[model samples]
Target: MIDNSLGEQYLRIYDELNFDNQASRRVGFCTLENYYATVMEHVGTEVLNTGIDIFGENLAEQWTVTKQILETVDREPPSEFEGILQEVKKHRGNLYHNFREDIPQRRLDAIRDVAEEWRAWLIDCAREYWDTFGAYTLEDFDYIANEINDYSQAYMGDIALKLPTIKRELDYAFRTIAKQRHRRLHYLETPDIFLYDLMPNKTSSEISKISTTYGKIGMMASKIKKGEEIDTDEGEDLMYDARNILISICEQEDPFGRTFNNLHSSE
Candidate 1:
């Protein structure tokens, strides 16, 4: 869990600033300082809790939690992770120590973005660490840890790119469910057509393309289910084409057919 004590402090400062109005410009500054402090504390705590192995003579040195986390995962810290942590720290410093009359919205936005990236990285690192060396030795651990870190980094990067689309797709799904409920109550019949035709048995590349295609289909389905008429002239054609492809693929005999047939016959 996240430590909320500092957040509470920042909230209290904000409340004070709001109450005093003109007299509390200084209070607003103070609130900004408190907020930065809180954010730093939260980030620090998260880094520590990830349970990274920090070995070497400098272990006793006051290394940042982010450094520790990366070190634990790869033995050698990643430059990318280090860079993100530095950016977060820089923003925190600016929010705390910089006594400018007006806080730039851009600075705050940058800080928020950095925080989000930090959180995503930490989560990915935790998963990679756990999955790789939940039970392995130093040599085995090193190899697996490196591989898992590389995989996790790539995976996180890809997921980050798709976050906006993922959110849209999920929102569409919820809306579609609500609409479907309404339709069931009124029409008392479910739609027979599948909005997206996907073949789980297909090759990885095909599956990935279908996943992306179907995600859009899912969003479209949500609109259709809601009784909000969507122009699916293009969507309909794609769906029809996809279904035909899936049907053709499914009808093909299994590659291990003869061996399985003989085994079954023997049994």
Candidate 2:
């Protein structure tokens, strides 16, 4: 699979471009330009490193990775990709150097279309390389597994501690219904648990309170694992005390705007 980072960057570019304001559109264009440069640089660096490793040859410098690869590497990108690269360069240059405050929406849309082509070609090139040569070593798997184990405990522990009673009751109910029907059947709805709600003026139920406390505890544990400092005087009791204070405040039924203004004013 292509790295999630690349997908995330693409999503950011898409989201910013869709904003209703010109400033946001400009920012989207800037982000798209930077990401385009970064991916090209990464592809060039990979080709250069691989060439040095396999063929022990130095490649000449070029304005872009696409050009460098054509000159140095044995492989060639699709003929049409070069044309798309030129289109990408034109947009990148205009966005970078043009002093005009407002870029036409139609021009931005044109660049976006070209950018999609550029990105698709780059991803295909990357995928071809990875398919030709495997992407990782056994050591890499060990490292990834160890990292997952370290963080997963904080999450899985929260679920295990809070959901056993509910899960057991649901299981019993489902089994009873299955026995009546003389066939094994799954629950009608999948179980999903949320840890926190961020909206203002929303009061938490009992389970929500527990989930919030668990979220804090998990956060503290993560910080400790990362060797960051936490409030030591309260020890492990900090989450409980914080939850109680939040509950007390919520019970007051105070106006959210006044409460927010007062809190910030005091700060």
Candidate 3:
């Protein structure tokens, strides 16, 4: 039996390793599930008569995108051999004296194996359905691929591109900081001071530059709020500067978080 302290440590390690993976896995599973359902709905009576050959090389080609999406989300499909090995280990553990040496590692390995198998099984079920009912011909594959790609692009792009969505994100950030600082949003008119106060680690010169750019953005946001016209070129420049500021700060604090290195690169 594992001691409480060791078990807790193992749990912490598992949580840390799976933090982003859990979200990615869930998203991947959901995407595959929806894809399967869509294909089945479209195929209808064609499913029973359809064979893998009917898809030609189209389904095989489309699988590239499916695999790409999974990889983008960091989804790792489980290995059947690994699952079998885990089962054998579990049976052995039951039949003989439990291996006490490195028990935490063994326990963690078993949990990871089981978790992987569970996610893989979920994805496999969807893939099986999709493979069976997805496409009747090359044309079908083309249509389905186009539809799925469009949906995926639109869904992901809207998160950061839309003004309302951006405002909501910014508002949430501000409200969170406001609560932390015990300040009200209605009274928080000067973003320059508020931002300066929050970013104490920044040099005064850097804060001054940020304040100046922020003032321009603030004015643009005000015009937007009041349904007034603004210059598109000015708005785009402000957007670039704001993004560059974030990139610069993140690059200093967390090299890994910098998505783009060229601050002056055109959007």
Task: Evaluate candidate 2 by giving its C-alpha RMSD to the native, one decimal.
Answer: 20.3
lDDT of 1 by residue, 1-267 (tens): 333233556555454444333335445544544454444444443333423333321112223654565566684435754554455445445544655544444443443344435444544554454334331223432433343344444432222233333334333432332232221221112211222221224566654554455565556556555655555454544344334333322222211221222323544
lDDT of 1: 0.40
Provide the lDDT at 217 for model 2. 53
Error of 3 at 135 (Å): 48
Local distance difference test, each candidate: 0.40, 0.43, 0.41
Steric collisions counted per model: 1, 0, 0
* TM per candidate: 0.28, 0.35, 0.29
Considering lDDT, where higher is better, how would the candidates rank from best to worst? 2, 3, 1
Lowest lDDT block of 10, candidate 1 = 183-192
Q: 36-146 in candidate 3: lDDT tens per residue?
A: 323322232122222233133332333333444344335444465345334434443443353332223354354444443443343444334433333122343233344
List the candidate 1 regions with Cα displacement exceeding 4 Å. Answer: 1-63, 75-84, 91-102, 133-267
Candidate 1 vs. true structure, TM-score: 0.28
TM-score attained by model 3 = 0.29
